[model samples]
Target: MQAPQTKEEKQLDISLDELIYKVRELKQSIAGFIYKLENEYQHISWPNMMEHFGVLSSQLNSVKRLLKTSKMPLLRNYVLFPLRLSPDRDLELEKLTEGRVMAFSHEVVPDYLRTKPEPEVEERVQMMSVKASSMAPDTTQKQLTNLNKITANLLDTISVPSASDEREKDSSLKNALPQTSSQQDTNLLIGAITKGHRLLRPEPQSPMVVGPQMGQMQPQMQQQHPHKLQMPGASMGRMPSAIKTNIKAAATSHPYQRP
Candidate 1:
């Protein structure tokens, strides 16, 4: 007689694809239930309403239970506060880390990270930090001073003028200009005199006949003297007298001559 053979175990693992299909089918069933109630309400009697609601409730509960028991859990997002951990901050780190579950897989870690820092190395690091801290202000101050000088040089090069300078320039220009009417006239007269021209006396005409008429003309000459020939009171429209018209001066070497 042969011994009884054992049956093979069925695969029990459910993949994400199977979960998605089941969830999609449940969602479709619930959606179709709502659609049916909305579309067939006029035809549906009051006795079928409770049954329809019951079917909807069962379908929703099935989907909820499936999601709760599935391999993938619901994801919740929250803010992660930034923190820096140091030897002095160990208490805060411990408080943060207390009662926190940790999970990890096999990963390669560098051996250098596992080794503790030597005391001499820590001392050198602290000294270097101190030296850097001491030099920071000096370097920053030097750079700031250099930038200030550069700005000052740029301001000088740009030549931003003041109102006072403009006023001074205007005042100088005004001073250079002629200030008085007399001065302006003098300037115009000088310009005219320098235009290459010279003044000359007028030409002479006929001389006086003083041979016989000297005695008789003495009284008339006294009445109408050379200064009285062009009388200011004479009528401009009147013809000149024969004696005054014929009594013109002769040309002479002398600059002064009588009429």
Candidate 2:
């Protein structure tokens, strides 16, 4: 009911313009598919994704078929010299001639476009280049001044004397220390220690009372500490006026007679 009258034909003699127009249409179709994928992929809900892929695959197949059936297969079986650049150490601009091998290095200008240098000028330049190979050294040198310690021996053996030094120190300490001769020596040591303690003892600093109602208190305190030693002249020099007054009062109250 839809297309019952249509018929299929096959000779397929296509013109170049028509073929190019078909290729452009295929390109447009592929570009439109890419545009949809980039901009409207999230918004579009695809009913059949495979069918759209199949259309693109079919387009690719048609392009392959066209290339395969053409007079020229267009295989890159041989290298075209001008398309790729290769290094040539012997390559010189002045020696370039027609049909000479050329490469796209430094300058890719054609032979006809290159202006030939003068022979005298070229010779002088070559001589100058040859003379000045280099007077300076390379960027780096062998570092002979490194901090690597080189020795004939590696094992460290500690001498017996070094271990004996600590033992010797212990023995020397035992010899240097004084030994107790008898009980008299111990008594003498005790007397010296007691004298040191007596010398280091701080003198008592009693409050001075120079005003009224303190006369009775002073006499009582002096009576209680009558045997208290008097401070030396050197110590009395550092004493305040009140301390001097108190010391004088205590000395006056002392019961010492000029015996």
Candidate 3:
């Protein structure tokens, strides 16, 4: 029988045939190295790496199917060359295995069909019923009332300031008052004394003219006696002396001391 084929078909067949040969060669080389490690480098025998190789074999089979399905020319070559050469034994491979195991347990395994019965929902419902049965229908209202009472008590306790707080507030107010009050009182008393002095002791009316008349009158008025203005025959000199004496007596009579 003659094998009839197109140019594309022949090329495809040739590539596929070459890929199969390379795959077989790669598997043989890998098996030979694994045997050598097991017998000779037994101490460094990577059971884990070997396990990965088994998984890698399965991956290669998957790649074989992919190559057939996709008709990609280069996939087999990429898979084959590395398989023929031994990989370095490293912790990276161990970590990969750990990750794969984790993925299997956490992501892959749980998604697999679960045969175990789930009693959690039923148990939760039953527990809820049991709790419900243990309490009266009015229990929620009673609890609400009790909670309100507790909250009211808590708020009252917080809102009402303690004795210490009140004392501190009062003390703060008292301390603040005296600092401002004493200074204000001193200013008020000084102002009152100045006002009273202006009212009771009016200055002599300024001389109408600003020349010698005022100047002459200023000394005369300063030298003039107070009793002459009010008494019958006292001299201006005696009047001033009496006014000085009377003013000193009046100043001594006042109870308030000068600031």
Candidate 4:
């Protein structure tokens, strides 16, 4: 008998052929997607939603195609994809933190702040301070009184005059000045005599010979006097003879008689 061809080998060969045809189809799809994306991106304005959305759509479609064509379950192997256990872990952590924050917010803090007193106590303190301020110091009052006394004493000292000195000055002026008319006349007569003596009878050392010459010349003066002519009373303006005789007698008795 000839050896039988195994059926398992036949199935393996068909599956392998099917996988190759799927890979070829995937390559063609990827090429068409790349061409379409490139054409749209180049023509599209940058920063537009359509340009970015088209790139993302192309990537997601490529990934789906790779997953569909491949034999391996690649979702289990990719670490960069956000479709794994990371989202569940993040959600669980956020829920736990929120619950903890709410519990803390509801808890109460202790009351440490204090309050002040009433208005009555403040008024009582102010009244006591006012009463204390009204009192005075004994020493300061005494010092002010002493200062006033000293000022009065200084005024008294400056106002008093020297009585005895004033009296002495007045008495001395009285003694020095002339008192009566007779004393003044005597003073005038003495001054006249002093001046006449100075002119007529000089000192012992004088160049003039005055005293004896004046005495000797008196007798010769009588003879020269009779020879000098005298006017008769009748020749004068209406002079009587009796009146002329009286005038001659008065002239002889007078101290100023010439001869």
lDDT of 1 by residue, 1-259 (tens): 2333111111112434555667666767777767878898778877677776777677677666766664543422222333422333245434544523121112212222235467788899999898877787979799889999999998876654443355678675555555656664564455336421111011112224335534543544344222233322222212353333233432343367656
Off by over 4 Å in 2: 1-23, 77-259
Estimate the TM-score for candidate 1.
Answer: 0.21
lDDT of 2 by residue, 9-61 (tens): 11122433445656776877787888878888887667545666778788877
Write candidate 3's Cα lDDT for 94-200 as tens digits.
48554433322233333343444358977888899999788886997799899999999998888655533666776866654455557655644564364331112
Candidate 1: stretches off by over 4 Å = 1-15, 73-259
Clashing residue pairs found in predicted model 4: none
Q: Candidates ranked by TM-score, best first?
A: 2, 1, 3, 4
| Better by TM-score, candidate 2 or 1 | 2
Q: Stretches of candidate 3 above 4 Å error?
A: 1-4, 47-55, 58-62, 72-259
Higher-TM-score candidate of 2 and 3: 2
Least lDDT summed over 10 consecutive residues: which range in candidate 1? 196-205
> How far is 136's C-alpha from truth in model 3 (Å)?
51
lDDT (C-alpha) at residue 18 in model 4 = 60
What are the Cα lDDT values of the candidates? 0.49, 0.50, 0.54, 0.50
Candidate 4 steric clashes:
0
